[model samples]
Target: MSETSKMLWAVLGAFAIGFIVVGLSKQEESPEQKEAASMIRNYVTIQSMANQKCPEAILKQTGEEVYFPSETVSDKETYITLKWVGEKGFKKASCTVYGTLGGISELIIDDKVIIKKKI
Candidate 1:
Protein backbone atom coordinates (compact mmCIF):
# COMPACT_ATOMS: atom_id res chain seq x y z
CA MET A 1 0.00 0.00 0.00
CA SER A 2 1.12 3.58 -0.59
CA GLU A 3 2.65 5.36 2.43
CA THR A 4 -0.09 7.99 2.46
CA SER A 5 -2.85 5.36 2.32
CA LYS A 6 -1.21 3.33 5.09
CA MET A 7 -0.94 6.45 7.28
CA LEU A 8 -4.60 7.26 6.76
CA TRP A 9 -5.65 3.71 7.67
CA ALA A 10 -3.50 3.85 10.83
CA VAL A 11 -5.12 7.11 11.93
CA LEU A 12 -8.61 5.73 11.45
CA GLY A 13 -7.67 2.54 13.30
CA ALA A 14 -6.33 4.54 16.23
CA PHE A 15 -9.50 6.59 16.41
CA ALA A 16 -11.65 3.47 16.34
CA ILE A 17 -9.58 1.79 19.02
CA GLY A 18 -9.68 4.87 21.19
CA PHE A 19 -13.44 4.97 20.99
CA ILE A 20 -13.73 1.27 21.86
CA VAL A 21 -11.45 1.59 24.87
CA VAL A 22 -13.30 4.62 26.18
CA GLY A 23 -16.65 2.93 25.77
CA LEU A 24 -15.46 -0.20 27.57
CA SER A 25 -13.93 1.78 30.40
CA LYS A 26 -17.17 3.70 30.92
CA GLN A 27 -19.29 0.50 30.89
CA GLU A 28 -17.99 -0.58 34.29
CA GLU A 29 -20.04 0.85 37.15
CA SER A 30 -18.18 1.52 40.39
CA PRO A 31 -19.54 -0.07 43.56
CA GLU A 32 -20.26 3.32 45.04
CA GLN A 33 -22.23 4.35 41.98
CA LYS A 34 -24.26 1.16 42.07
CA GLU A 35 -24.98 1.70 45.74
CA ALA A 36 -26.10 5.25 45.04
CA ALA A 37 -28.53 4.07 42.40
CA SER A 38 -29.95 1.47 44.75
CA MET A 39 -30.31 4.08 47.45
CA ILE A 40 -32.22 6.32 45.08
CA ARG A 41 -34.65 3.56 44.22
CA ASN A 42 -35.17 2.77 47.89
CA TYR A 43 -35.70 6.42 48.62
CA VAL A 44 -38.49 6.58 46.07
CA THR A 45 -40.20 3.49 47.44
CA ILE A 46 -40.00 4.73 51.03
CA GLN A 47 -41.37 8.14 50.17
CA SER A 48 -44.39 6.41 48.66
CA MET A 49 -45.10 5.12 52.13
CA ALA A 50 -45.88 8.65 53.22
CA ASN A 51 -49.45 8.01 52.15
CA GLN A 52 -49.67 6.11 55.41
CA LYS A 53 -48.98 9.59 56.95
CA CYS A 54 -45.46 9.34 58.42
CA PRO A 55 -42.86 9.90 55.71
CA GLU A 56 -40.49 11.88 57.90
CA ALA A 57 -39.19 8.74 59.58
CA ILE A 58 -38.24 7.11 56.30
CA LEU A 59 -36.79 10.37 54.98
CA LYS A 60 -34.55 10.63 58.05
CA GLN A 61 -33.40 7.06 57.64
CA THR A 62 -32.54 7.57 54.00
CA GLY A 63 -31.08 11.02 54.63
CA GLU A 64 -33.13 12.28 51.69
CA GLU A 65 -35.32 15.34 51.52
CA VAL A 66 -38.87 15.06 50.22
CA TYR A 67 -40.42 17.75 48.06
CA PHE A 68 -44.04 18.06 46.99
CA PRO A 69 -44.16 18.22 43.21
CA SER A 70 -47.65 17.95 41.77
CA GLU A 71 -50.90 15.97 41.69
CA THR A 72 -53.31 14.28 39.25
CA VAL A 73 -56.82 13.00 39.67
CA SER A 74 -58.99 10.43 37.88
CA ASP A 75 -62.42 9.00 38.62
CA LYS A 76 -62.74 11.08 41.78
CA GLU A 77 -59.40 9.77 43.11
CA THR A 78 -56.29 11.87 43.54
CA TYR A 79 -52.65 10.92 43.13
CA ILE A 80 -49.75 12.91 44.55
CA THR A 81 -46.12 12.86 43.48
CA LEU A 82 -43.22 13.51 45.83
CA LYS A 83 -39.57 14.02 45.01
CA TRP A 84 -36.53 13.02 47.05
CA VAL A 85 -33.24 14.71 46.33
CA GLY A 86 -29.95 13.49 47.72
CA GLU A 87 -26.33 12.48 47.11
CA LYS A 88 -24.51 10.91 44.14
CA GLY A 89 -26.83 9.09 41.75
CA PHE A 90 -29.62 9.60 44.28
CA LYS A 91 -29.84 13.19 43.19
CA LYS A 92 -33.53 12.89 42.35
CA ALA A 93 -36.41 10.44 42.76
CA SER A 94 -40.19 10.53 42.41
CA CYS A 95 -42.85 8.79 44.49
CA THR A 96 -46.60 9.02 44.85
CA VAL A 97 -48.48 9.21 48.12
CA TYR A 98 -52.27 9.12 48.07
CA GLY A 99 -54.86 9.11 50.80
CA THR A 100 -58.19 7.33 50.92
CA LEU A 101 -59.85 10.36 52.46
CA GLY A 102 -58.90 12.87 49.75
CA GLY A 103 -55.36 13.77 50.85
CA ILE A 104 -52.71 14.00 48.12
CA SER A 105 -48.95 14.46 47.92
CA GLU A 106 -46.71 14.58 44.82
CA LEU A 107 -43.10 13.61 44.32
CA ILE A 108 -41.15 15.30 41.55
CA ILE A 109 -37.81 14.42 39.97
CA ASP A 110 -36.62 16.94 37.50
CA ASP A 111 -39.77 17.64 35.49
CA LYS A 112 -41.51 14.32 36.11
CA VAL A 113 -43.62 13.23 39.06
CA ILE A 114 -44.18 9.64 40.16
CA ILE A 115 -47.82 9.31 41.08
CA LYS A 116 -49.85 6.86 43.13
CA LYS A 117 -53.60 7.31 42.73
CA LYS A 118 -56.09 6.31 45.40
CA ILE A 119 -58.95 4.12 44.21
Candidate 2:
Protein backbone atom coordinates (compact mmCIF):
# COMPACT_ATOMS: atom_id res chain seq x y z
CA MET A 1 0.00 0.00 0.00
CA SER A 2 1.06 3.57 -0.60
CA GLU A 3 2.26 5.59 2.43
CA THR A 4 -0.81 7.82 2.31
CA SER A 5 -3.13 4.83 2.19
CA LYS A 6 -1.38 3.31 5.20
CA MET A 7 -1.82 6.56 7.17
CA LEU A 8 -5.51 6.73 6.17
CA TRP A 9 -6.11 3.19 7.43
CA ALA A 10 -4.36 3.99 10.72
CA VAL A 11 -6.54 6.99 11.23
CA LEU A 12 -9.64 5.00 10.43
CA GLY A 13 -8.64 2.31 12.91
CA ALA A 14 -8.16 4.89 15.65
CA PHE A 15 -11.52 6.44 14.85
CA ALA A 16 -13.22 3.05 15.03
CA ILE A 17 -11.70 2.32 18.44
CA GLY A 18 -12.73 5.72 19.73
CA PHE A 19 -16.25 5.26 18.43
CA ILE A 20 -16.57 1.90 20.13
CA VAL A 21 -15.32 3.36 23.42
CA VAL A 22 -17.75 6.24 23.32
CA GLY A 23 -20.69 4.01 22.44
CA LEU A 24 -19.87 1.55 25.19
CA SER A 25 -19.50 4.35 27.71
CA LYS A 26 -22.93 5.68 26.93
CA GLN A 27 -24.53 2.27 27.23
CA GLU A 28 -22.82 1.40 30.52
CA GLU A 29 -23.55 3.59 33.52
CA SER A 30 -20.76 4.29 35.96
CA PRO A 31 -20.87 3.15 39.57
CA GLU A 32 -21.28 6.77 40.63
CA GLN A 33 -24.46 7.09 38.58
CA LYS A 34 -25.98 3.94 40.08
CA GLU A 35 -25.07 5.14 43.54
CA ALA A 36 -26.57 8.52 42.80
CA ALA A 37 -29.83 6.91 41.74
CA SER A 38 -29.96 4.78 44.87
CA MET A 39 -29.23 7.79 47.04
CA ILE A 40 -31.91 9.83 45.36
CA ARG A 41 -34.54 7.14 45.95
CA ASN A 42 -33.63 6.74 49.58
CA TYR A 43 -33.51 10.47 50.19
CA VAL A 44 -36.85 11.05 48.53
CA THR A 45 -38.48 8.19 50.42
CA ILE A 46 -37.01 9.19 53.79
CA GLN A 47 -37.73 12.84 53.18
CA SER A 48 -41.30 11.79 52.56
CA MET A 49 -41.41 10.15 55.97
CA ALA A 50 -39.81 13.17 57.56
CA ASN A 51 -42.55 15.29 56.08
CA GLN A 52 -45.13 13.01 57.73
CA LYS A 53 -43.90 13.96 61.23
CA CYS A 54 -42.77 10.45 62.07
CA PRO A 55 -41.11 9.95 65.43
CA GLU A 56 -37.45 10.91 65.69
CA ALA A 57 -36.71 7.32 66.68
CA ILE A 58 -37.96 6.19 63.31
CA LEU A 59 -35.82 8.82 61.59
CA LYS A 60 -32.58 8.35 63.51
CA GLN A 61 -30.23 5.61 62.34
CA THR A 62 -26.67 4.91 61.25
CA GLY A 63 -26.75 7.18 58.19
CA GLU A 64 -28.97 10.12 59.00
CA GLU A 65 -28.45 13.70 57.84
CA VAL A 66 -30.64 16.69 57.39
CA TYR A 67 -29.94 17.44 53.73
CA PHE A 68 -30.43 20.97 52.45
CA PRO A 69 -30.09 21.28 48.71
CA SER A 70 -29.65 25.05 48.84
CA GLU A 71 -26.41 24.71 50.79
CA THR A 72 -24.89 22.45 48.09
CA VAL A 73 -25.49 24.68 45.11
CA SER A 74 -21.89 25.85 44.85
CA ASP A 75 -20.51 22.32 44.65
CA LYS A 76 -21.85 20.21 41.79
CA GLU A 77 -20.23 17.00 43.03
CA THR A 78 -21.51 16.97 46.55
CA TYR A 79 -22.21 13.58 48.13
CA ILE A 80 -24.89 13.30 50.83
CA THR A 81 -25.94 10.65 53.28
CA LEU A 82 -29.66 10.45 54.08
CA LYS A 83 -31.61 8.35 56.52
CA TRP A 84 -35.18 7.24 55.79
CA VAL A 85 -37.32 5.77 58.58
CA GLY A 86 -40.48 3.83 58.02
CA GLU A 87 -42.49 0.74 58.93
CA LYS A 88 -43.68 -2.09 56.68
CA GLY A 89 -46.34 -4.22 58.37
CA PHE A 90 -44.64 -5.57 61.50
CA LYS A 91 -41.07 -4.98 60.35
CA LYS A 92 -39.23 -1.66 60.53
CA ALA A 93 -37.64 -0.36 57.37
CA SER A 94 -34.84 2.16 57.26
CA CYS A 95 -32.84 3.34 54.30
CA THR A 96 -29.42 4.95 54.08
CA VAL A 97 -29.18 7.37 51.19
CA TYR A 98 -26.05 8.76 49.56
CA GLY A 99 -25.17 10.10 46.14
CA THR A 100 -23.85 13.03 44.09
CA LEU A 101 -25.49 15.11 46.76
CA GLY A 102 -25.52 18.30 44.76
CA GLY A 103 -28.94 19.66 43.93
CA ILE A 104 -32.54 19.38 44.95
CA SER A 105 -33.62 18.70 41.38
CA GLU A 106 -30.61 17.01 39.86
CA LEU A 107 -31.35 13.55 41.19
CA ILE A 108 -34.54 12.02 39.84
CA ILE A 109 -36.09 8.61 40.46
CA ASP A 110 -38.55 6.98 37.97
CA ASP A 111 -39.82 10.43 37.12
CA LYS A 112 -41.87 10.22 40.28
CA VAL A 113 -40.17 12.11 43.09
CA ILE A 114 -38.10 15.23 42.64
CA ILE A 115 -34.93 15.28 44.74
CA LYS A 116 -35.95 18.50 46.39
CA LYS A 117 -35.86 17.62 50.06
CA LYS A 118 -39.41 18.20 51.20
CA ILE A 119 -39.38 20.21 54.39
Q: Top model by TM-score, which number?
A: 1
lDDT of each: 0.52, 0.42
Off by over 4 Å in 2: 28-35, 38-119
Provide the TM-score for each candidate, comma-separated. 0.30, 0.28
**CA displacement after TM-score superposition, residue 72 of candidate 2 (Å):** 13
**Per-residue lDDT of model 1, residues 1-119, tens digit only:** 99999999999999999999998888778899998887666544544555444245335445554445343222222334444455643466555554443333554444554433445
> What digit string (tens of lDDT, one per residue) describes model 2 on residues 4-75?
999999999999999999988777778999999876776665455433322232333312332322222112
For candidate 1, give the lDDT of residue 119. Answer: 50
Candidate 1 Cα errors over 4 Å, as ranges: 1-4, 45-119
Error of 1 at 73 (Å): 24
lDDT of 2 at 112: 28
Candidate 1 local lDDT, residue 37 = 85
Which pairs clash inside model 1?
80-105, 80-106, 81-106, 81-107, 82-106, 82-107, 82-108, 83-107, 83-108
